[model samples]
Target: MRYEVWAPSASQVTLHADGRAYPMRREDGGWWRRAAPGTDGTRYGFALDDGPALPDPRARRLPDGPDGLAAVLDPTLSVWRHDWPGRPLPGAVLYELHVGTFTRTGTFEAAAEHLPHLAQLGVTHIELMPVCPFPGTHGWGYDGVAPWAVHEPYGGPGGLVRFVDAAHALGLGVVLDVVHNHLGPSGNHLPAFGPYFTDRHHTPWGAAVNLGEPEVRAYFTNSALAWLRDYRLDGLRLDAIHALTPRAPFLPELSSAVDELSQSLSRPLFLIAESDLNDPLTTTPRSSGGHGLHAQWNDDFHHALHTALTGESQGYYADFAADPAQALAKILRGGFFHDGTYSSFRNRPHGHPLNPSTTPPYRLLAYTQTHDQIGNRAQGDRLSAHLSPGLLACAAALTLCSPFTPMLFMGEEWGARTPWQYFTDHPDPALAEAVRTGRRREFAAHGWPSDAIPDPQSPETRLRSCLDWDEPKREPHARLLAWYRRLIALRRATPALTDPDWSYTALSTDDRTVHFRRGPVHLAVNLSPQPAALALGGTAAIVAAWSPVAPPDGAGVLHLPPETAAVLLAT
Candidate 1:
């Protein structure tokens, strides 16, 4: 196959083949090279006579820096044995993990050790934080430099293949989080070859990846399929897709392309959209004037649940904490916040009510704690520090017992003590300093003291974020683990919990207790510190409790102790 690098501004381009550097022809206003016999592994780098040497635009397997010689890699050689397909639907439990912090090794091989514990949690899917190669070893994978290649430190492409194979062997499905918006500044060498990004659109990170031009559009779809076909990824969690808006027509062609590819693949592929638009169209079918996604992260639910549980009102949390009982009730039953009401955040009326009767409930992924809520904090402290034990149990129940696909962040199950701090190991000194300054500026808007913000580039930041394997084996941590294990067991036992019909469930809450009704199962949660009498929607048979004490067994008033939760079946 012939290789081409786009350095349109270069006066002369040289393709270093083997030991010889041969000047390439400027065909069609770009550099071109044809491989000779036995040239599959021939390493080549582009020498722009005017500018410094840059990496190949389509370098799939980069063992070295961007300036290192790029070679043509055959993707067919990698033997994938992930024969089993992913989860069927709401039947699956998901665990969201950060590649860098999952283990101290921070490589794919090191992460393999925890796959067994995940299986014990009855987890069916493992959602890996972005694997796209970034500058350094530490990051949430949001700032990816190479959208296609796996990060080298995290075992690169080969280690990833082994990780996936191992996960499937343990009967777990793997979903990859991919950032299609902006590239991290450090190791990004794409612009040196082609106009992969457009000056028209810009996201919070930087200019959005170009999906307008024909070749650019093709590139993204190809990348999407490669994960499924080559890496054996079951699903693609589309990150910040709301930031992607097409030029004039306003038609979201990206969604259409994904759907088309999913159709052609003929496999059980899933697409989860992570959008805060609160627009049901994000998960709605394309025929219904929506972006045909399988399911999307429900931020409104998180906001309502977080504010209600923790009561920390700053920035976006301010608009939500006002009437959290009502906000959460709507999300619990309807799946969105605005539900045709006005939103103070956007200062406008927004969101259509989700048709719970017609719409499957699992389409919404609910979580009280996620990386955003934790890492975005002045200190990346988990909610374990903020809420009481009862409240923590309440939040986990709210997610797992609700009519949605529940997701648990890493270290959330046992109430991990270590905070998931934001850290970067960028090679570029200027970019590293810029990140620190940017973080300080962002937190200041939320009333956080600028000087108190931890440096995003510091070693202490990443070190603090690493999980302590011993923590789960001890104390209130052990108690927290037991609570989660029992809750997950109960959630799996009760078919009503995962039922798709939202209409079958009813919820009513006061300031002290939150009530959830699924068919005959009633979950009453006490958020207060003192014992209180709670009126049951109906008389219930006690099935489960978060604490050691059993709830009263009767068809009358149920009494609960401080920071307690109970699950019951109507007698």
Candidate 2:
């Protein structure tokens, strides 16, 4: 077998495999290679300039975690039981889940047992949070050091293979979230191997990954393809593309490569970027000189809707809180609220306007809450913790009934009571203390008492984030779940709800209510504390509603209870 590594800075390279060491010869493009008698399950690592051996930068399986030696395993060797066609993004209802806390056992095998529940929930795709190897057994999976390998604690590569196969059998597509901007602080050995990162640009984590180099770009691109091709994943959700300050046009290049692979496989493979730039170019076609990603997370819509429902005016929520209804109305008509507008949070003009005629609304993924929105909070409390069942149903109605592609965070369908807190497991005591201190200090600066903030390093914090399966079987929770089921069913059944056209969409708002129309379907949400009598443009029949909605009056006005939403079909 041939062993290879990229260590341009090293004068000497050695391949340590299967308890034997062999000198490697320098190859072109800053790579070192050597042939050895080894097969699958062979332990391997690379030593640079007589230094300690490090795991392969692109190791497919890290059997002993990121700090341990990598195992040589053929990914194609895994057997797939089901044949999956593919699921596209146009009309998909995405459900994002974290593998560790998704089930009681926190393993891929255990998570697979709940696939039937998601299929029944009417979500077309399950977006799994990063499963790459991190420091410990539990985490949000964002600070993963190995961008290519699966976390062994979550069943490694084979476990993910089995999980995807099971999901395919249930007619569900799986999308994995990937982090390429920066790796975790501890156990990251990429810099030692080569100039994978550069000090030319820095992100929140530190030096950015060097994407200008041809070989470095290939490293990340190949890792993404391996996940989709080898694991049979439908797509990938890129975490924070805005943080990446690549001197080269990496997004466009990545998209082109992915498109070529999608053609070869004859499947609908795609990429979704988590960007706050509010740039339509992120989703525009490559031929039009755009990045050509299939879709992006619409944080503008989330902020507007969140502030409206919760009356929050802190930090980024300040701008949206001024006039909640108007904010929601603007996002409904166009795709973004910031569209070349001044942002009070940033104190600058942010985002470019998107043409409704040129850009389809479905290119934006809208959600009520996300991992960052929930987990990063002081207490990691979900909206369900404070909002009533009626209000939660209202949020469901607006998102599902909107023109954009809707996504649900795990346990949102049933309003899972457990909090999805920020938790980490770093074996290093000093690193753990630093994380604990930083988390508390950040929240404390924002007026939250330090004691009120959960310790990210505490084991109890991770346990508190697990979803309670029994919650869905109880009152209010069961009712909310039923509401989500009906809303999703209606979206699938009603052509107007899933319509991608933005020109056909219209919105109107009063002091306490926001109304929008998608073709013949009109949705009105009452945001006030008192009952609202919203004027429908024409005579309509109540199709779906969060609470008991009174019939339209003689003048075509519907009386909706406070904190309620109704979807009406024009007669």
Highest-scoring model, TM-score: 2
**Could you tell me the lDDT of residue 392 within candidate 2?**
85
Candidate 2 structure quality by residue, lDDT tens digits, 269-348: 99999999999889888888789899999999999889988988999999898997788888888899999999999999
TM-score for all models, in order of appearance: 0.92, 0.98
Compared with the true structure, all predictions reach lDDT values of: 0.77, 0.90
Q: How far in Å is the alpha carbon of 58 misplaced in model 1?
A: 2.5
* Leading candidate by lDDT: 2
Looking at model 2, which ten-residue stretch has the lowest summed lDDT?
498-507
User: Candidate 1: TM-score?
Assistant: 0.92
Q: How accurate is candidate 2 locally (lDDT)?
A: 0.90
Angstrom error at residue 443, model 1? 2.2
Clashes of each: 0, 0
Per-residue error for 494 in candidate 2, Å, reads 1.1
Which pairs, if any, clash in model 2? none
